[model samples]
Target: MSQVSEKAVSFEPEEKKEKKEWKINVFAMLLVLLVIAAVITHILPAGKYEQIEKNGYTTVDPNSFKWIASTPLGFFDTVKSIPTGMVEAANIIFFILIIGGFFGVLKASGTVEALVSTMAKKLANREKLMIPIIMLFFALGGSLMGMAEEALVYVPLFIPLALAVGFDTITGTAMVLVGASVGFTTAIMNPFTVGLAQGIAGLPMYSGMGFRLVLFVVIYVIAVTFVYRHAMKVKRDPASGIYGKFDTNEQDSLLTAKVELTKRHKWILTAFLINYIILVFGVIKYEWYIKEIAALFIILTIIIAILGKISLDDTVESFTQGSASLIGGALIIGVSRAILVVLNQGHIIDPLLYQVSEEMKHVSPFLSVVGMYNFQVAIHFILASGSGHAMLTMPIMAPLADLLDITRQTAVLSFSFADGIGNIIFPTGGTLMAGLAIAGISWTRWARWILPLILIEYSIGLIAVIIAHLIGYGPS
Candidate 1:
């Protein structure tokens, strides 16, 4: 939900850890679901709905639902549907690639490193203030800019810094993980989750910023409070903290803290900030969609590369490398899209939707929102990639919301909060695992530490979705 770059999950038969591991590979999981969707087509009656686009948003005529001949996808068709799904989802896939490249160029220019160093230094002496301040910094990054994977690098950097200041590694690790997740849960302008979901739901990009901003502050405070309490506990009694088997001897080249914030770095960050402002204005005032947002990122990449004084060859290489890194994420989007393709071709989606409509019609509106929120939270364990989850679910959920008389924006918000909050507890989350690996904390330990907060945040997400539904959050 936060970062669009996906790292391939390593699922090699762990001869040693097989007895311990309980996770399924995301690719294998998606493929299995694709097959299941195909199988469902043969079992259920086929149906269709005539779609009509009004005011740029598309919706199905509920009364226009009709039976259609079943056209089940064969094995070859199902496999072929994967690439076709990519084609259908190309707009979102490319948007991720461009953002990856944009961030890559920024990374190559040493801007992010400088930014991190500057922040760490600014909070160096404020031992009591460190947890809240750094946590808020990351929360803002995630809510406004979608900073998940990028925040992973902070784990090692902050663990030692946190230890030196009398706090434990978990305290430092929680700052980034919890902070970024809180912002993600209350996403205001995050392109990957909220942006893509809104696009699919046919809502204006980054609309409803006001409510999200308020939620962001509330979540930020909650996250900071949790981390601060734990950090102080550890500060007072080191033995009370669960360090696991963390390797205190682990070292990194960046640990020396020599990355200087040069004037050029400041300018680059300023340009980065300005680009986001432009993106907000363009979307709000000019009605920019995916294409316009993508174009702005491309332009910003070029501008940042030039300002960073990166050589022409290096800039091109950086862009290529960045785009290449996100290939897995891009493919996940397309692969998830294929599931929809198979469902649509089988003519089963409409029937499924019809059933859902009937099933939800009698349910209380508030309970229905809560049910949707809980469903997203449960599903996030398997589909941890925020964009991938959006691609797989939004197309269906958007229309389903229309039938339930719930705003599609509410649906999008539900997905956002569900996917974002689940990441902190989901063992399958790569960034979570990576951060813990850096801190030398085990999954068991991390889960035990964060489970309470996870439940609290889950409740918050449910409330947010219910409120959104009551208020009719939407452009439609």
Candidate 2:
């Protein structure tokens, strides 16, 4: 799902703003691990477990672990794994590509810009509700559709609105960044995170949704409340805003420009809304996965391009350029998969799961659950792609959850919580980086303002994990 995000993302900042530069390159760090894992294969004992596939997801047979001859990966194999992992991760990689392409077509049509303009006009005076309302919209989008990179497109759009509302660039950025994060961290039906994790964990699609929906509301409240307080403070004192390199003269011109929605824009937006309705229906009723979801976007892309009367060449170019933008995210998915590739090829995955299961047995189930959450947070910091993270971890975590006397649902919850919360907070997260870049905000500055909210979001995840355990969350 990720290579596409890296490729399809194309944001033109209003102007280059000089600001503090922070360097913690996640890609270089993640790729280096491929070699590290290959080296570890020579030291970690080789073992295997029988795996059975059910409904298109793989589950390891916990009873079938057996020691195997070591097959350590040489340096050459580690280098070769880049392409191999991408090919293995094609399902999600392509899904992200098509989604990126689709959004490219949509953005090129100027509907998103038009919508942002409309929102700014209506919300100019209702500044107090902007945080709660705007953030709530983004939070709902995240829980419902696993929105992350999609939120980046709105970052530039919101900056002017924030300034117009007498707030800062950070406030505007937070509306798009943290707004979606609340629902993401407390996922309800996010196909990318909870859905993929749960499916691999061998639980029903969207099971235990009742508790998740509740968690979604609570987390959304916290997120909006946090952002609201900051927004209002900035509104009261323009000097209080963290504009970084943000210049009032340059940004003010953007807000002052007229953005009247035309009849064509109305038709285009209607088509977009209908497409989402179809998307939700297909996912819920037809049990659509990556291929189906990607196909839906392809169809919508065609419809939008035609209605917008964009030339075939322009449409293809836009789609291609957008798809190209997300290539990094897509490649990262494959490269990250290479780490698991080394572990799996060396037959050490089962032993690792076994060791983790043994460790959990020494602790309370609650502690085990928290450990799962924390481990996922650590993993998500490195592997930002939700589906890629799921493919890497769920095989081991599912059976480990079974062994720990905890429901797979709880394990999925932990994965969802960890996976979602880290996206905005971590420097490695492509979406977070992209959003900060688009808003012209520094990571250090964004972290200072959002760290407290991150802790609160983490607590919500912890509470949800604990509640899932106490409720014995599963039909499996």
lDDT for each residue of candidate 2 in 302-410, tens digit (9 for 90 to 100): 9999998999999999898766656656666666667766776776666765676668878887899988888888777656778767876787788878877888988
- Residue by residue across 1-476, what tens digits does model 1's lDDT show? 01111110111111221135354555676678888988987889998877766435454565677887878888899989899988987776687667657766877787665565455566555778877888888887777767776565455456655654556667878988888898789888887789878887778998888888888888888888888988888767666765543322221222334668899988987887897678667755776667788888899899998899999899998888766656665666677667777877888766765666557667877777777777777667656778767765677678778867788888998899887887788655656654554455656667878888888887887888888898898763
What's the lDDT for candidate 1? 0.71
For all predicted structures, in order, the TM-scores are 0.64, 0.77
Candidates' lDDT values, in order? Answer: 0.71, 0.72
**For candidate 1, what is the total of clashing residue pairs?**
1
* Model 1 misplaced regions, further than 4 Å: 1-22, 125-255, 360-455, 460-476
The most accurate candidate by TM-score is 2
Which pairs of residues clash in candidate 1, taking residues 3 or more apart in a chain or in different chains?
A: 1-386
